[model samples]
Target: MSQSQLVELDEAAVLGHAGQALAHVYFPTDCLISLLTHRVQPRSFEVGQLGYEGMLGAAAALGVSASAFDAVVTGAGRAWQIELPHLRALTRASRSLTLLMTRFLYFELSQMGALAACAHFHTLEQRLARFLLMSVDRLRVADLKITHEALSLILGVRRASVTLAAGAFQEQGWIQYSRGHMLVLSRAGLLQVVCACYRQDLSTYDQVMLGSTAAQ
Candidate 1:
């Protein structure tokens, strides 16, 4: 814990470059980080998100030494970061830590798989709702300090798509959108709009990492 430093994540700041060394592990308190892929042309899309309930570098903790995607801060908030060497040292001294991280990596893979399907099959409106719900789950606020441009970038869609979808959401009274931010007005409404992917992801993480953290 002494080695951990809490820092504010600037939105869109790149934490991990693809194929680069995984130098640190991040434990989010209120921050949100997204795993992004830029392998395709034109834009990058999110593969998964990590927040207070999750940690970055679960793959590295499982012995993967490099990142496969770019890890970017999607929301500006504070998280505790510990250098990778320290994390490896901790694992060497603790069996429980190793098990806990292994379980987390399994849980992380499930999220990635679900998101892959969601991205490929779900409508933009449904996917946007799911993303909103996921972001709100880790923060203490109902308002998302983001813009349509950011959403378009995160979802790998055109900004016009985000604008049209957001308009529909605003018209339905599920959210309030302004110059560069959004406030969710109805949690139940957003839930109704989102797919089952959001709920499954949360449930799996809770089951896999909850209480198991105490063991670590």
Candidate 2:
């Protein structure tokens, strides 16, 4: 841990951009990183998210240096970062490190695919609930700070839709959302509204990342 540097990431800060070569791999402890992608129009749309459970830019160690999506700091906090060259050297020196990176990168790809499908097919409310639940799991906090505009950019939806979803969730006693602040009041209630994709993603993570036979 002493070798890893801790850095504070501000909200909406871009960590990786399209076609840009990655210099560092980030291991988020309390921060949240969202991978944004778009086609036809230049707009931010989230395709995947990472937190304490994962790392961003590990592909660089495998010779995939350029980023395909915009990796942004969505939930502001701290993360541990290692230089790409250093990580690559470490992986070369340690077979266990190489194996871990291979496993993590594979899991990250599956997570991205799942997120892309959920974003396209699921309704805004359902998608919102799923992401919100995922966020809470990563943050391990009951309260969240988010703007409707920011969520719109991430979810690829209109801010008005987020407004509606937030209101409805509030009415159901799921959260208390107002003025860019949201306090999750009922995790169980949110689980009820979120699509099956959320649970499936968790189960996959448990199987592949955690090596757990018990389902999530």
Candidate 3:
């Protein structure tokens, strides 16, 4: 922990490119990092997210050196970063730390699976709601500095689709959007609009990561 340094992440900053070797692990204090899976250049979708509640480079901590997805900073804020080798050495020195990291890795994989299923089976509105809800929960801010174009990239949809859904949300007084900013007006309304997968994702994290932390 003492070796870790506090760093500020700018929005859209690429932390680690896909298939590259990871050099550091980041634990966000308020930032949001998206793990993007790519099909082609400029065509990628978010598979997982890390924030204050989670750490990037779980695979590295678990002994995998290569990154499977690109890690991009979605929300600009601060985080604690440590060298990969240093983190791995600390894990080797502590059994409880190893267990906690193992559980976090499981939680991350579970989220990816759940989100993939949600993308295939759920409506765009529901998925959008889920994304916004998750973003706010992670960033602890209602006014998100994002645009419809950015939302489309994250949700793997056309920009027009995101515009349509966001328009509807604004009409319903559930949110307000202008330029590149979006303010969530009603969490309850979003809860009603989001799919069951949101709750399931939260439950999985609570059971896996939180339970591990508690046991430790």
Candidate 4:
């Protein structure tokens, strides 16, 4: 087994390179990481997000050696690292941990399904609102350092569309944007504008992680 270490990552840092077998699993303590699918056009769409509630190298737990998504740090956070061998051993020995991680995996799959439907059926404005709500929930913070270009890639839309949607939000006083930073001003208003998928995903996470005691 390899030694356990705590790693601190800065924003936009690569947690795992594409096509590389995960050598270590990372349990995020204060950081948020995004798992994105890189495309031929050099575009990327976020497929999953990991925070203090989950670990980064989840594919390895399911017996997959390689990752399809590029794992990048979306926020500054701390992660406890354990080598692959140690992680495997721990998972084998602990049924509780295995069940807990399985629950997270199920939630992740549901989130992906929700995102796929959202991409197909929802408008850019609705999708953007949903994205903001999800980010706020994961970071538990109001301010987000993101740009229209970044949002465009994540939403699989044109930069112009992102700009327009963001403008609408700003005009309504739902958010304050300056430079590349966005501060959510009206959480309730944002939620009202977002589609139902956001709440559905949140409910799944709450039920899986916190049971009936989860916050609404």
TM-score of each: 0.94, 0.93, 0.96, 0.88
Largest TM-score belongs to which candidate?
3
- Superposed by TM-score, candidate 4 places the C-alpha of residue 88 at a distance from the truth, in angstroms, of 1.5
Tens-place lDDT per residue, model 3, 100-164, is 88889899999999888888999999999999999999999999988787788888888999999
TM-score of 3: 0.96
**Winner by TM-score between candidate 2 and candidate 1:** 1
Candidate lDDT (C-alpha), each: 0.87, 0.85, 0.90, 0.80
Error of 4 at 41 (Å): 1.8
Worst 10 residues of 3 by lDDT: 37-46
Which residue pairs show backbone clashes in model 2? none
lDDT of 2: 0.85
Go through the candidates in order and give the C-alpha RMSD of each one to the true structure: 1.9, 2.5, 1.3, 3.1
Comparing 3 and 4 on lDDT, the stronger one: 3
Please give, for residues 55-171, the per-residue lDDT of candidate 4 as tens digits.
887668766788777888777767888888788778889887777777787887787778878888988888889888878777778898777877877788889988889999999
Give the runs in model 4 whose Cα sits over 4 Å from its true position: 1-3, 212-216
